[model samples]
Target: MAKWDNMLSMLWMLRSGRKLTAAQIADSLEISVRTVYRYIDALCASGVPVVAESGHDGGIRILESFKETPLFFNSVELKALVDAFKFARGACYPYTEELESALKKVENGLHEEQRHDLSHQTSGMDVISPSRPPSVVPLLRELEQSAKEGRTVRIAYRKANVEQADEREVDPYGLAFDRNEWYAVAFCHQSQTLRTFRVDRISRLEPTEARFEKPERFSTSAYFRNQSEREREADGPLAVIRIEGEPDTLNALCGHWHLRHYLTERTDREARFLIDVPTMNKYLPMYLMTFGTAIRIREPLELKRRIQEMAYGIAKHYENDPD
Candidate 1:
């Protein structure tokens, strides 16, 4: 098991409020007694306040202060947690039932005055989505189970822009949620390499009895970091767009949650963007049009030509409209 997983298991045991000794923890987790002690040291270093008592009858436990506080959250901590759940709920979280129940339990533990205060604080915040996406809860659960059990699953997957569904066997390593989407990062037997498949795109999933050992040093985070570096080095077409707008407008463009990763550089008077899309097709035109006259394509005459053509088409359509 990974050190992180081990730590989490230990934390859960301590959270149960039952006295657990290093020997008991090692036996349950099937790890060495020394490892249990090391994990305890790590927890203490990270401010967990895990108290260890020395003696034949003594054991380890979390500080009593945590037991009094619900999940060890103060009023401020409670507000932050509620705010996160609020955004996730508004975005149509897949596990809506679980989220609601958990939130209720947390609030139930609070005093009546605390609940009233939280209600006021939450009313001032909001997360708005045009439409709720379909729930990915079923798929999420299967993927999590497969990852934990080290089992291979046959998944019926639909690739983007492709209508046909293909079946493939994958060794699940971990699941990741990003940009309001969930993905399974796993070792693909079909592609003979690691690939990421969107959980929503998976139409059907069937877990198999076949199990595989996770690679010794494989990490989803490291894999993504290496993939990003490789993409940056790839030979791809680039477009330099000069942005001239107010400071706030420029900040808005840069600070957009989804667009922030693509931005390479910016300045006070102007900003330069490196476009990766090969063609100035529908996606590029539609995106650039959002900025209106505030942006100009500095290079790639092809892109400028396409935008001009699109602008002419729009003008023709609205030529006879009454103002």
Candidate 2:
């Protein structure tokens, strides 16, 4: 009969200064008056301060100030909350213990009927992410707090492939969880240059009394737009080239953030992209085959010649010719 469960529900319902008679409680609990009285005794025995007045105008009332009472849920709400946690479990952030503890409270609070529906046959779901050694979630939290409060912070940051960590004085602007990686974008005090530092590689944060002003136009979205290296590639010259490829591959390639602002096509087999590209990185002939015989590079003869020479070099790699 979920005796204790029903009594707890009754206490909560009466907590709002609303009186509930034995008959109403009994009907809601699908039990008899005799059982209701016994449950009321159970609550009082547990020091819940449940008061029941007798006679024609008697009812049940619990002393106020009870705030942590378990919530009442039907089957639908229970199912919805379960689904919510199932999805959160996929995010795979560092809240494992906390999330499970919160879920347990929900588990213990469910009414008997709803509990059955929740525990009934359902497919178990899981999230897949490469658990690359633990990273500092706490630092990200502190970084966010500092940025939001307009405070300055210090961090020992080591760039990728560097030998040592350097003390960086940064005025925090904002953090981004882009494509599953966390980036802290801010102004570097040492270099007097703006930079984006990866969150995982950051170690040790110290908050200081020094206050720093965030740039007025430092919108995170706008900052992200300028992160590409293509625009900064020497400013040597801009070139447009057309190539042909299958539609789906072209579609996926075109949508890449680096390519999106620069690509277009006249037909499924043919497309064009303009890149603010540098010179030394080109290996021409090999790059041309990327279109798989259906596409051709139509501009900048130097780029096309580079492609042809690279193809010859590659052919020489497998040929019997000594030259």
Best by lDDT: 1
The candidate maximizing TM-score is 1
lDDT of candidate 1 over 1-323, digit per residue (tens)? 77767888888888998889889999999999999999887666556789989897789999877643224345667788888887776655657678878888888866567789888877888877546335467777788888888999999999999999999999989877666667789889999988999887898989988999888877776665566545553456766656667777788777654355556788875666665655334356777777788776665676778788889999999999999
Candidate 2 local lDDT, 157-254, one digit each (tens): 98899969989789889987665567889888998978888887787789988888888877865677666543554666667766556787666556
Cα-based lDDT for every prediction:
0.76, 0.70
- Residue-level error in angstroms, candidate 2, position 118: 11
**How big is the positional error of residue 309 in model 1, measured in Å on the Cα after superposition?**
18
Clashes of 2: 4
| Segments in model 1 whose C-alpha atoms lie over 4 Å from true places | 1-75, 91-96, 130-135, 216-222, 233-323
